[model samples]
Each structure stands twice: as structure tokens, then as C-alpha cells.
Target: MKTVADIILHNGNIQTQDGFHPMARAVAVSGKRILSVGSDRDILGLASSHTQVIDLDNRLVLPGFIDTHFHFYEWALNYDSIDFSRVGSFKEMENAVSNKALALGEGNWVLGQGFNESDWPENKIPDRYDLDRIAPNNPVCIWRCDLHLSVANSLGLKLAKIGFETPDPEDGVIAKDTSGRPTGVLKELASNLIRNVLPKPSRAAVLENMQKAVGDAHKFGLTSIHDIRLMGGLDGADALKAWQQLHRENRLHIRCHVALPGEMTDQAIDLGLCTGFGDDLLKIGYLKFFSDGGMGARTGWMTKKYLDAEFGMPLTPVADIERAVLKADQVGLSVMVHAVGDRANKEIIAMFQRIESHDRTRCIIPHRIEHVQMILPEDLEKLSTLKNIAVSCQPNNLSLDISMIDSCAGPRGKYAYALKNILKTGVPLMLSSDAPVADPNPLAGIYSAVTRKRMNKTPEKGWYVEQALSVEEAVKGYTITPAVASGTGDCLGSISKGKIADIIVLDQDIFKIDPDGIADTKVDITLFDGRIVHER
Candidate 1:
């Protein structure tokens, strides 16, 4: 008995992602899954004469890209906020802020993101006085490109309830002016003071934005995404409920793997919610823990304090993070810790080792350390032994962190975003955009991974020339590796029999082109469940 195929995509250079079939000419689909992948004759044999045949006419096709770490709400939030990401000068930034404030009516907080002081002509972070002169009564909060640092206006500080008497929290910074008054520059955990006061988006807004994000993702050749932080807590249970509501109403499109935050991890576990608790539409990813702050904010925990800084590395003491990982593991939740600096990576490796010894790899939890930036050579070697422990690294960091890297790490800045070093360690590497932090463009990320060039197109041989990965290796990070890390490898990553038919067609042969040209390649078509989601 033969299974009847519903759709057949013929006459294309199919990059299987699977080692066995590396390249093929066609693929046949039945309903929502791949029925067969081979020559046109082989596929046509499985397809009925009435089946729809999509003529590729000699194009390049590959598995849909998967992002292992991204923030859905943060990306969607930009749809309604002032975007200052392109400001090249303080005057430009000032004008944009002032104009936006004047038009925003009264009493509303004028929020914006993606400002990098290093790129500004004056080399100065805009202060409260600059904002006060523009907006006056309206409060303002402008986030640094990393999304880890922010500068607030005096009114914004007051709204966040900060005062001269306020003490900096353990993991955050309150940058004050020379006169001892709050200048409104906040770092790491301190920025949350204002974030906590901000209004939560209504459920209607979440559904709308998530849909928009999914549509945008498909246009970029993305089929699966792992959302790192869900703003409304409890595994972002409220957000998931809304998504469920949308899915039930037949409105949802993309596949989401939610990374439950530490704030809601205990409660979720207590409620017996474990990893992969949902179906193909939505599922639990990992138990996310912040072992350290971000690189751009200069807050990533380090073995040694950042050079010349008064405060040493800010970290979630090893004991605290370890306890959390251990507990989550006991209840079948995989741990995904953000470890950027050497000390942070070392501590997280220790936590994984402890869990590996105790749990003996039960249920194959894809425990991973996010960022894994600036890791010690020893820790990388240590990570190689744990089969289930993976690394989700943002290759685009090279393009975005050049200035922050130079400012914070000096010459070693070259070693900061080492994707190749991570891959060489034998641990599976996953790729992501951390979108809103970086655009969710895998081609941009892959280009950065291979060339290591910053936005200005500087650095001919890349930051650390020896650490640049080949284009083939970079594709695996965006495809099968992330699928494996997210626990959907068996069903979603490859274009093979029994795998869900999620595919993307490219207009150019990225593999055959020069490393720089990879960024210029465009997505021609995107499919989910064998149905066209986006076509260009």
C-alpha cells in the first residue's frame, strides 16, 4: 500500500541539512509532513496525478531557520515605540526625542530603545538634563542597544520611585551625577525599577503582536522560535493562555518554545508543569536563569572585576543559581542559564556537571548555557563531555558589540563572541537573534558568524580570524542544532521522512557565494506544514 502525497516541490537544489542527503532535487509532501525526498521521478511516484506540484525551476531550498533565543514582546513593542536605533549623533537623538515628545501629547512616558553611546559623535550618553529640556513634563526612558542599560529623565526617575536616598540594588546600578543627584542612567537590574512601573500590554495586544511577529518571521524564513523571556510571569502562562485562545480560534501560525523565567519557575514546577508540556503548537523550552548581566551593559559576571570599576562582577551567587537549576531538573525542567563572562560560564558548567551526576541524563533535557560569551578554554573543554548540555550563542554579537567589546574587554574583545571556539569544543551550538536586541535575521547572523565584521564592514579578517566558522557549520547552528536543543529535533529540524514539512526557499546560493554576499541573500518562499506561509 502506498501513501498518497498531496503536494510535490520539484526541480530545486534541496539542501537536506541531514548528512545523508546533503543535496537533493525534489521533495514530496503528504498533508502536513514530508512523505519522500529524492529525484523528481521518485517524488512523482508517491504523488497522485491530482496532487499540486510546485515548480521550483532550479532554486535553493533548505530547512526553515530556527531561533533558539528571542524576545517576542520586546520585538513587538517596537511596533508602537520611538525607534532611535539609527541616530548617529546626540543632536539627532535629541531632535528625535524632542519631536516624539511634542507629538505624544501630555503625561505619557516617551519610551525608546537601541542607543549606543560609543557610536554617537560626542561619545556621551544623553543625560537627564538633555531629556528635561525636550520633554519637560513627559517622562522618558531610552534603552541602550543591548536592552540591558537605560537612561531616564528626572520625571521618569520620580515615576519609578527613585530618589537620592535610594541605595543601588545588589545586581543593578544607579548612575548619579557629580552633584550626587540621580542623573537617571540605570544599569542591569536598576533599569527594572522603571520597567516595573510601565503598563503591561493588554491580552488583546499580545495576541495581535504575536501574530504580527509570526508573520514577520515567516517572511524572514523563520518557522520556529524560542522566546527567552515572557513578560507576564508563570512560564508566561498568561501569554501562553492567550496564544492557546488564538490557536483555538485558528489564528496562530508559528511554533513557539517558551523559556520559563526563574521568577515563575518554582510556581510552574509546583503546579506540575514540565518541559514539552504542550503539543506542536506550543511547548515549554527551558528554565531560564540569569547568572550574570549582559555584555553591552558591562555587567556580565567575571572571575576578576571589570578593570578599574568600583563594583566587581555582578552575579547571582553560584549557590543561588545552582539551587534553582537542581530543583528545576528534579521536576523535569531543562535549565538554560545566561552565562557571559568567564566566571559565569565556569559556575554554570559546574551546575550542569552536578545535575549530570545526579540525574544521569533523565528525559534528555537540553540543558544549555546562553551566550557562553568570553568563556574559559577549560570550561569549553569541560562542556564537551555533557552530551545533552548545549550552547545557544548569538553570532550577531560580533556585529552589534564591537564598540562595547572594545570598551570593556580591550584586545581580548576579539575573543568575546567566539562562535567557532564554542563549536570546536564538541558541544552542539544553537543560533538566535535575541531580537529587538538584534534583528531576527539568520542570514545577518550567519554572515557575522562567517566574516565576524561589524556594521561598518570593518575588520577584514574578522575579530578573531581563527574563530570564524564555515558557512555550512553556521547553517547547522540555525537549523538542526537549535531544533535538537529545543527538543523538537525528532520532528522539526530536518527535511526528511517523518519530519514536519517546514521549509524555506532562497533566491541565491548562499553556500557558493562569498562570505559577505551571504547577507545579501533573500528569502523567496516560506512554508509551514507544507502550506505556503510567505512567498516573495
Candidate 2:
């Protein structure tokens, strides 16, 4: 008996992202997998009377995007929080917080995120005093755009019990004034002091917000994400539980790969959890480790002193991370280390090389370097030599970091965000948003990668034009490469026969449009597991 397709989309420009059948005019979906992909007539022939047949009207259809390093749990929880992503000055930030504080009433915590001082005209980092002036009665905390730093108001600091006498945590710093007073600027794990005190939303509220966040992700054409864990491992268990609960309730619309924090390596090993341990919708990803902080905070460990600042500090010692990686690797779990600066990337790459050489029988699951934001040419070459490693870079962050890097690194900025160069090394390069830190829209990321400019398309010639990728390369970074990174190359990344039918139709042909317009492109329809989950 001939298998009938549940849905047939014909007369479309389909980018399969599959080597064998890279382009197709139509695709037929059977249940939750692709039944056939061919010419219009061939695919339409697979449709039966019960099949839902639709004409694509020549729209561009492609594999659903996969964000390899999204902080989904954090993004979801901040769904209701104040957004400072668009604020242009300190005055605007203050007004925004003041408004929120007024609405939430006195003593109520006011939490917000996505503030980049680099974007402000003053270019001044917000401190506790600034927040205090705006919302003195409220315990307020706002995160820098990178999540590596946060500023809390005086009330918030008091509530967190942080004072001038509070010693810096092992991997964190609480900035102080020259007068020996706390400045309210928390870096790395120090933000946990404020986070630990902030009220957590109920589990039910988290699930509800997560459901909304899923819809928002679909709108941006994201069908899958690697839900990255933060440094302290505070949200690791809760994040996994939320995903599991969503899966159990059949509400998990997006494919998720949940990462375990490196801090939980012992616990994960004891529980016998390995990477790729779950079903398709949700799977255990890598054991996430941090080598250094973010560039925005000027805390990204660098080989040399920044032109304007001191050499940044390491968040986790290199030797400590290597030990944890070895333990996890022996048990079949891969590792993803966050390395943002040249020194950090060089050290982490060497660690991976050492592990590879010392253990010939290590797990096949590829370890990854998150935010290879800056890499010396030598480090990039070394990274390429590791057969069992991948690098996840964020172009959206590239859009955000260009000016910051230029100001801090000077000539060394040339090696930052070297996307094209990294690809030349024969290593899989995955593009992701690192959401809540940067915009999550895959289109925005693609725009940044191809244009090497902010959304407004600045500098006219583009920054580090040599690193700019072609439209095809950027698209592949979000599609096929991510599949390869996640060890799901065979089934999830492309539109091929017998592959999972996670696909999206775009309103415009990104490949044909002007590069600047790519960020404005929208997803017209999203098909997840062969079901029409979103239409706009």
C-alpha cells in the first residue's frame, strides 16, 4: 500500500539543507516526518483525499532554525520583566525602572535585563547609586546585556545582604567604591547574591511563561534550541524539570537540548546521565562550563590587557574545567565551555586537545566551545585540529560587540568574531542567539553574520568585512551545522526523506533580498512535527 502524505506543500522554493537534494519545488509530510521532497507534481502525487494540500505560492521554505545556545529558561522567566534593550541613555533607563517601581509599589522587587552601556550616549556603567536614585524604595536589579554583570539598587543590595565587608565569591566580584563602599555592580557569580534573594516564580507560572515563549520562538522560525544553563547551576534542575513537565503534558512544541551545568557534573555522573539521553523533543545536551566572563563586562579573560582596561579575570580555572571535562567525557557526556577572549579560547582549546590525546576511547559526542567570541589565529588553528569539537558563535552578539571590542581591544579586535576564518578550519560552526543576552530572532543573527553590522547597518563598509559570511553560509550555520553539533545530523537539520518535518516558510526570499532586509524578514508559517503550529 502506498503511504499517503498528511500534508503536501507544492510550488515552493525549498532549501532542504540536505546535500543530496538541496533544492526542491515541493515537499510531502507524512505524520511527523518528511515523506518525499521533489518537484511539485511528484510531491503533490503523494497527497490523498484526506491530505491537507497547500500551495506555497512560491514562498521560500527552509529547515527550521536551531539556536545552539539559547537560555530559554531565563528568557521565559523574564517575559514579564522590564526590557532595557532599546533604552538609549541612562535617563531612559532610570525612567523605565522608575515607572516599573511605581507600578509594582514600594518594596516590591523590580527585575530587568538587556542594558548595554556601550549603546548609551554617556557610556557609563549603571551602579547601585543610579538605580537607588530611580527606585530607592524598591529592591531593583538590572542585568547588563551579557548576563555576566548586574547592577542592583541599595535596597536590593541590603536585601541580598551584600556589603562592603562581603568578600568576593571565588569566581565573582562585587565592585566597590574608592571609599570602601559597595558599588552595586556585580560580576559573574556575584550576581547570584541578588538572584538568590529575588523571588522565584511558581513552577506553574514558569510553565505558563514557557508556553508563551515557545510561541514567540516559533514566530521567529526557531524549531529547536539548546537551552543553556547559567554559571551557578541554580536553574539547572528547575529548567530540566520544566522541560520534562512540558513534554509529559504534550506542550513542548519546540525541540530542546537541555544542558547540565558543569557544577553538577558529579551529580549527573552519579545519576548516570549522558548527553543526548532523552527523546527527540527534549534531550540532555552538554555539561556547560565557563572559562571566563563576557566581553561587555570587560571581564572576558584576554591574553593582554585591554587598551582601556586590565586583563579580564577567569571565572573558572582552566585546570578545574579540564578535570570536570575528563570526568564527563569518560561517562559519554560531551562538554561545552564558554570562552569569550583570546586567552580563554586558547586555554580551553588546549584543554580539549589534551583530553583528546590522553583518552583515545573518549565518547564520540562532540564537545563544544560556546562564544568563541575572540580567538587568536593560532587558537583557531588549534581548535580545528580537534576532531571531537565544535564552536558555537553568536552573530547577534557580533552586532552588539563591534563597538565595544573596537574600544577595548584596539587592533586585536581584528581576531574577534572571526566567523569566516573559523569555518575555513573544517570545524563545524554553529550560530545561535544566546537569547536574553541578545535578540533571539534567527533572522537578526543571519543579518549580523552576513552584514557584520548592527541592525541599522552601520560603518557603511561593515566591521571586519573579511569575516562576513555569505547568505548560504549564515543560513547553514543556523541549520545543518547545529544539527551536526547536536549529534542529530541524520534526522533533524534538513528537509530530507525520513527526516523529521520541522520546517518554516518565510514571507520573503532571504537569499534574494538585500542583506540589510534580512532582519526584517518574517516567518509566514511554521510546521513542527508535521503540524501547523504557527501562521502569520
Candidate 3:
């Protein structure tokens, strides 16, 4: 019996990402998998009268993008939150919060996020008094773009029961005024105090919002994501439950690999959960751990002091991380640690080396280092030696952090966001948006990676042009490399026979355009599971 394709896309420029057959003119999709990829004639021959054949008109088609580090649950819930991503000054931020407060009418919580003081003219961190002045009657809390810090109003702080008398929690900080009064600025775990006290949305509301978020993701050509867990482990269980609920309801259009919090290693082991535990639609991913905070917050556990002469702090001690990694490894669960500073990266690399030395027998999935945001050259060399290790970097963050890193790290900024250098070391480099921290659009990420510049195209020559990746390399970072990280390389990365049919058609050829314009490129069509999920 001849196998007939359910759908056929012909006369298209398809980037298969398979070395042997790197490019194809057409593709045939049967059910949820690719049935054939070849010249237009070959694929068109597989189409029967019932097949839905579409002429691509020479449009660019590529594998669907994969965001290896995304806070899906968090982003979905904050869909309606006030966006300060474009706010330019302290007054602008104040006005935004004030407006939200007035609209919600007193006593309701006014929550906002994605404010970066570094981008503001004032160049000063907002304090509780700043928020209190604008939203006095209503409790207000706004997060820094990096999410490593947050500022709340006095009412918000009082509601969380945090005051000068309250001591900082482990791995967190409560900034204080000169008079020793609470300043409403919380760092790391301290922000969780307010988060825990905030009223959560109902499960039904979350699911509805998540479905909308999935739709938005499809617009950006994202067909898969590694739904990352936040620090403090507050959202891990809920996040996993949400994804599972979406799956059970038959509403999960995008593939997801939900990570388990490192703190829950024992529970996962007891439940017989390991990496890649579920089906293709969803699976258990890495055990997530944090080695330090973000660079923007000056809490990234650095080897040296910042320009302000302050050394960053570690959220989790190196020794503690090593112990957890070893324990998780013994149970066949890979770990992904968030390391932002040079010291943090160095420590994590050494820890992974130690693990490899002790246990070379287990068939463990490749462990990962998230946000290798900053690292020394020697550390990069050391990282390359670990055969079972991969890296997930956020180019979108590089666009957000260029100015902040230049100001904080100064000369050492040369080593920050070295995408090309990291690639040279022979380690698998997966690109991601780290969404909610930065924009989640893969094109925006690709632009930043290739241009090493902000969306505005500043720094005419580009930031450390030496570190920029080529277009093909950046695309690989979002495609082939992420597939390897998620342990789905054989089935999800490329447009090959027998692989999952997750692909997208672009309105413009990103590879052929000027790198600066890549950020503005749009996805004209998106196909997930061999079905057209989105059409522009």
C-alpha cells in the first residue's frame, strides 16, 4: 500500500538542519510526523487527492523554535500585569503604577514587572517609598527585568510582614535605609515573602491564561519549550500540574518538558521520575538548581568585586549544589544549574568535572548550565572537557544586559555573552529567551546573538563583535542544539523523515536579510504536530 501524505508543502526553501541533506525544496507530513523531505516533485508525488497541498512560493521554512529556558506558568499568569518593559524613567514607572492603582481603585494589589533602572535616566533602583508615593492606598510590587529583585510599597511590605525588625531569609536580602528601616527592595528569596503572601489565581483562570500564552508562543514559531522553575521552588508543583492539566484537556498545542526543582529531588526519585519520563508531548526534564542571582541585580556570585567594589553573593552554596547534582545523577536525573557570574560558572564546571570523574558508568542525560552569562576563558576551556554537559544561553538577555554589564563588570565585560567563543569550545550551545526576563521571541534572540546589539541597533559596531554568532550558528542554537539538550535530537530538531512535523514558514528569509532587520521578521505560518496551528 502506498503511504499518502495528509499535507504537502512544495516549492519551499526548507532548512532541514540535517548535515547529510541540509536543504530541501518540499516536505510531506503524514499524521504527526514527516513522511518525506526532498525536491518538490518527490514530495508532491506523495500527495493524494485528499491531501492538503500548499504552495510555499519560495518562502523560508525551518524547524520550529525551541526555548530551553522559559517561565511558561509565570508568564501566563502575568499576562495582564502592568508592563514596565518600555518605561524609560523613574517618573514613567511611577505613573504606570499610579494609573494601575487608580483603575483598580484602592486596596487591590498593583503588580507590574520588567523594569530596568539601568535603562532609566535616573539610573537608581526604586525603593518602597517610591512605590508608596504613587500607590499608597494600594499595595504595589514591581519586579526588575531580571526577576532577581523586586520593589514593593510600604503596604505591600507590611502585608508580607517584612520590616526592619525582620531578618533576611536564607539566600535573600531585604535592603534597608540609612536609618535601618526596610527599604521595600527585596533580592532573591526575599521577594518570595511578598510572592507567598499574594493571592493566587484560580486553577481555571490559570488554564485559560495558559492557553492564550500558548497561542502567543505559536505566533513566534515556538513549538516546544522547557518550562523552567523559579527559585525557592514555590511554583514547581503547580507548574507541572498546569502542563499536565493542559495535556489531559487536549489543549496543549506546544510540546513541553517540565523541569523538577532540585529541592524536590527526593520526591521525584520516590515517584520514580527521571529525565525524559513522559511522552513526546510532555516529559520530565532537568532538576533545576540556582548557583547565583542575575548580573543586573549585582548578586551573581562573581570572582571579583563589581565596579562599586561589592562582590556578588551566591543563592546556593557550591558545596550544596554539588551534593544535589551527585544525588540526582545517582538517580539518572540530569541537572541544570543557573550560573551567571564567572565564579559561579567556574564552580559549576568544576563540580560537573568531579561528577564525571566519579560516575562514568550511568547512562545519564547531558547536564546543563543555564545562563553561562559570564565566564573566564579558562572556565570555557574547562567546560568543553565535560562530554556530558551542555549550555543554554539567552541572547535576548545579552541585548538587555549590554549596558548593565558594561557598567558593572567593566573590562571583564569582554568575556560576557561570548556565544562564538563558547561554540569554539565544542560544547552544545542552546539558545533561549529566558522569557519574562527578556522577550521570548526566537527571532529577537537570533538578532541579538548575531548582531550582539540591542533592538534599537545601538553600539554601531555591535557589542564585542568578536563574540557574535553567524546566522546559521544562531539558528542551530535554537534548533539542533536545544534538541540535544532536551534529549529529543532524533525526533524534534529538524525536518527529516520520521521526525515530528514541527515547522514554521517565514514572511522574510532571515538568513538572507540584514541581521539588524531579523528582529522585525514575522512568522507567516506555523505547523505543530503536522497541523497548521497558526496563520498570519
Clashing pairs in 2: none
TM-score of each: 0.94, 0.99, 0.98
lDDT of each: 0.80, 0.92, 0.91
Worst 10 residues of 1 by lDDT: 230-239
Could you tell me how far off, in angstroms, the CA of residue 14 lies in candidate 1 after the best superposition?
A: 0.7
How would you encode candidate 2's per-residue C-alpha lDDT over 137-248 as one tens digit per residue?
Answer: 8999999999999999899999999997999998899999898789999999999998898888999999999999999999999999999999999999999999999999
Query: What is residue 46's positional error in candidate 2, in angstroms?
Result: 1.6
**Candidate 1 all-Cα RMSD:** 2.2
- The positional error of residue 281 in candidate 3, measured at the CA in angstroms, is 0.6
Ranking by lDDT: 2, 3, 1
**Candidate 1 lDDT (Cα, 0 to 1):** 0.80
lDDT of 1 by residue, 380-472 (tens): 788887766889898886687776667766776655777877888788899888787776889989998888887556677677768888998
The digit string of per-residue lDDT tens for model 3 on 1-536 reads: 13799989999999889888999999999999999999998889998889999999999999999999999889999998998888889889989999999999999999998998887889898898888888889998999999999999999999999987999999999999898899998999999999999999999999999999999999999999999999998999999999999999899999999988889988988887889889999999989999999888889988999997477888788899888887778778888999999999999999889888985535357889999999999998898898888899999998888889989999899999989999999989999999899999999999999999988898888999999999999999999888976789999999999999999999899889989999999999999999999999
